[model samples]
Target: MIDEHATPDLLELAARYGVSREFVDWRGRLTTVSASTLIAVLRALDVDASTPDAIRSALGDTELAPWRRPLPASIVQRAGDTPWIFVHLPHGAQFRAWAVLEDGSTRDIPQIDNWIDPREVDGVLTGRATIVVPADMPRGWHELFVAITDDGATERIARCPLITVPERLNTAAANDETKRFGIMAQSYQLRSNTSWGIGDTRDLGALASWGARQGASFVLVNPLHAPAPVEPIEPSPYLPTSRRFRDPLVLHLDVIPAVQLLEGPDAERFATLSRRATALNATPTIDRDVVWRAKREGLELLFDYDLKDPVRKRAFGMFCEREGQELVDFATYCALAEEFGADWRAWPQALHDVSGQAVSEFRDTRADRVEFWRWVQWLTEEQLLEVQRSACEAGMSLGIMHDLAVGVHPYGADSWAMPEALARGVSVGAPPDMFNQLGQNWSQPPWRPDRLAELGYKPYRDMLRAALRCGGALRIDHILGLFRLWWIPEGQTPDAGCYVRYDVEAMLGILALEAERAGALVVGEDMGVVPPETRDTLAHFNIDGTSVLWFERGMSDEPLAPEHYRAHALASVTTHDLPPTAGYLKLDHVRLRHELGLLEVALEDEIQRERATIEEVLDTLRARGALASAASSVEEHTLALHRYLASSSARLMGVSLADLAGDTRSVNQPGTHREYPNWCVPLGNGSGERVTLEQVIASEWAVTLLEASRR
Candidate 1:
């Protein structure tokens, strides 16, 4: 419950900042937040609401904040819609507002409202006024300028960032609202003849080509976001060091032009490293650290090569210019991570801030190391671009739908470089729910809602811009975070946390703007417990939702009929978190969770519940004629599952690569990390023997299974 002793001033202040006093829990019961947690969250947002005097001061500050500013940090609206802009000035001051077009032209804006009641605070007289914007503004970012004068003798200027979005998000494709099937794969686990210990962009291209041959229109892969630049590289792609850059570890060295320069001694070293790394391909699990060590040595040698291609040099320079300080700061953090440690929090105080003098000096002194990291990013971009090109050339219409991770690693590059962009004490997580009764703290910081507004959402916008550059489609993991995130206060249980709100209109508008510019389709992973109207809201913005076949069943425990599925969604039979259908039909996930001690009930009791669920699925499949007979094998059930998906009206039907390749291991088991080889599991057979990409592309079962997905 909220603090019984809280002053009205504090309560009001919290409300104005979008702090909720009570919420309905997963059980659909009303729940109130504790006082300490609210105070901690408020403090994280830089509000001092600890005492009665502090509450009074905060209330006054909130009232005067908008009054002091001539304009808000930014204003967003739909194209052809006019919204009133507010301006504050000295009492009785007169002001005229105009829109400054991006091309340096100006248009007059008329005043809309009468004088806001005058007020005297701290012996200073202040007043507010409103400007009426024209309804025919263009669909881009422009500037709002207000010129003010107390007595027409002195002049003052105020400017704010203004944006107008499309009335609705344009569909990802022109005439593809109907069903289209694609393959979903964990890229790193894609075993192939040419894999260099780990999967590379080349393997992704090959997979797309194979999928296209099988009559697929798109291929969605896991997040390829970069991990730590140095050794001890993070394994999971979802927790990346930087969302704004690609991981070089996934690069195919054979495609780099610089590899041709290794003709003498460099060639020998490269071959040795290549041989050592490729040896691991025969193994069942991927060791990212070993792979990085070998790949880094090769990249180091390539970085020293003198490139004489002026055109390529110019392109690299343009990339640097476009990325600007963000790229530099990431590279600098990578360099310093080697010097002090990967965690910037424990680093010397002078080096904590990326903008500080110490970091500048370090970059100047360690220029070679910095450039080496930057060079890696350039190479990564080239290869990713090539991957998209290869996929399109192979006839995949919506080729390479890249996944965008929801958060960054807590102690990684983004956290180190831009601390102000994220909150410090609170972590983004979920409350205790039916899916996870213990609750889940992702261990990544949430973006401070106040800070994001103050910075005009540049950081969020920049990340989207980078992620959309090389892919034909972009997938946002956990898209609900754009509207509201569950912020767990430091050292507290997840249930003690509260929701922190964001400007959904602004976030979705910027996302739509960027996706449109990239000519890419947007897909939101709108699975699990989300806010009411989440699907409708995503649909309003033309963002496709995610639908899993297993969870689409009705209250009667029967799979939904084809007509019951969503029309604007990417429907799949299984996701990375669950096992392939073959494995699921055998109760593999239930067994694994039980073994991991993650089950809330007794193993036998849970098994009974799952068995009932499985029986229902089988009955549903039988009724739809998807299953051939009552004695169908596991592989047959897998096909039946996808056969059901193919009949759905969903826009994009997705078939897992694991099912196609006959791999049984889950790519990720959400409850446990080290207990299972989460992201390291290779695509293999039932015997746990690794299956090469060559085998998969030519597998008869794969060919047979794909037919079930073709409508």
Candidate 2:
């Protein structure tokens, strides 16, 4: 099955290395090789492998020139396909491989030569095949050619254009222009007057408006991504039911036209609910269930009144047309989840398959349910767009950057819609890093990278397009996943997870292309265990990285200066994971971390040290004549941090609204779920009353920070 001319003679190489052909086969299949094995291969090839450093030195000094090849046509494999062909070549060299069809047209294919298997080689010269064609190519005379060109020197090595037409199209070309950012209002305390129960779309719109006014080009909100169908829902935005749809709980039910149509006692009940919603908005803590319930009830009444308004129906039709089968499958998953208690596995066998007859019948019989779900998406999109409009009107440059979660819930709508895309038996998470030694199992299903690639990365491309549609930018949570992800097998601890690689070239390329089309910028969440190369790669693409204040300490044991910050980074004093500025100053952050078992050292000592450091920095500012107008109070100090961030060399700066209002609690506490009230707090005053957007701007501290930064 192997082409002799296109591959290295494995038996010959095996003999040269004094290793059997079987051993070579094993090495090719092994994902990770030991240092000894690596050394043996190097030594067998007459290369230095005495020590690890020696091996590196020898390879670095080789000075071998790169091999070049001609462009190849795109080839894709799908389910039930056989004989996958891979062209191998050296890394850091430009080679093109294109297929010549019957019409004499050429199509480009992806090239990767950094690593190759000796036994299964197809496209190689000397020890490698320059190109390989699948054995399943049609029984016709075809010519496949591989040209090696380096520094303008061209050499034709092999030629084959006889491959059969694959079932799918390959669309893995990389684009380098998309920028992303994140928003965190849900963590902020809610003000009562404008929000319903917690901070709803109205507040989100106002925040977007504020962001735009601050000269931000775009504002990225957390996954407005929908959650599971069942009650007592997971509050984490990362664990979403459907990445394609928005959460209904965030709907501004009061703004809907049907609310005005309520009559008599119905109107009174609606008024009472509105009043309660307004009251709840004043509360410090966000009651998600309560808000969801209120909104659901209100929506039910609205749905009953105007089940199919012309505009709403048209909007639904548009969504259906835009999303196509993906939306249909997602809505079906939601309906099925609702009936089967959120677990598709627990549902009847007929409903298990999205394309099954049961689903088709359900769609026909329960058309209203499907239409209602679609309507919810339409309204959600409308509200988000309105937020964007408000931001643009407010004179913000970028405005409304949205956050894209890393993965979808295991049993959520996305998994149901694209079961083949997700690894049903494994989950996505982080390996043990400096921050969390125990590691983290996010409990969200990850896409099967191989499957996604085979399908030409349609799912990923669609997602990026959707996210960039409404926002000026997008913040990819765990942005490293675009390159590699730690995959934990089912029933295993997170520590048992192993790093699975991804097509970084395709990922970044698609992102850049989409962002260029959408006129947006990209920001990667490169916090925690980010490799140095990741930063370098992101910088190469003009994608901004994140810089948080607490983590900006230098190796020299000195604080990082604002001027030292990279211009291609988004600088902020704190993030949703850290304590708000006010809470940090009050030492509440120290106590909270201690209580949550996150603190390893003495809490008092840590707090005192941190406080001293802050004071020392303030003193430095005073000495430099930069603190003369700085605020003296804790709230004022918080404002000063914003001013510092704003004045930093970084191109963009983010001010958490929680800090603006002096809210103490963090929006999320990483490890603990039930133990900590993560994602439950609203933006509000210390007394638990939800603060309105006006209140936030009116606050003396907010005004002080905003004005000080201007000076």
Displacement of residue 244 (Cα, Å) in model 2 is: 2.0
What TM-score would every model get versus the actual structure? 0.96, 0.74
Could you say which candidate leads in lDDT? 1
User: Each candidate: what lDDT?
Assistant: 0.83, 0.63
Put down candidate 1 lDDT per residue, 512-543, tens digits, no spaces. Answer: 88788788888899876677787888988888
Q: What is the lDDT of residue 402 in candidate 1?
A: 91
RMSD of 1: 2.0
Please provide the root mean square deviation of candidate 2 (C-alpha atoms, Å). 11.5
Question: Which parts of model 1 are misplaced by more than 4 Å?
Answer: 1-11, 152-154, 171-175, 555-558
lDDT of 2 by residue, 226-303 (tens): 887567777887778877777777777888877877888778878878777777765546677777777766776677
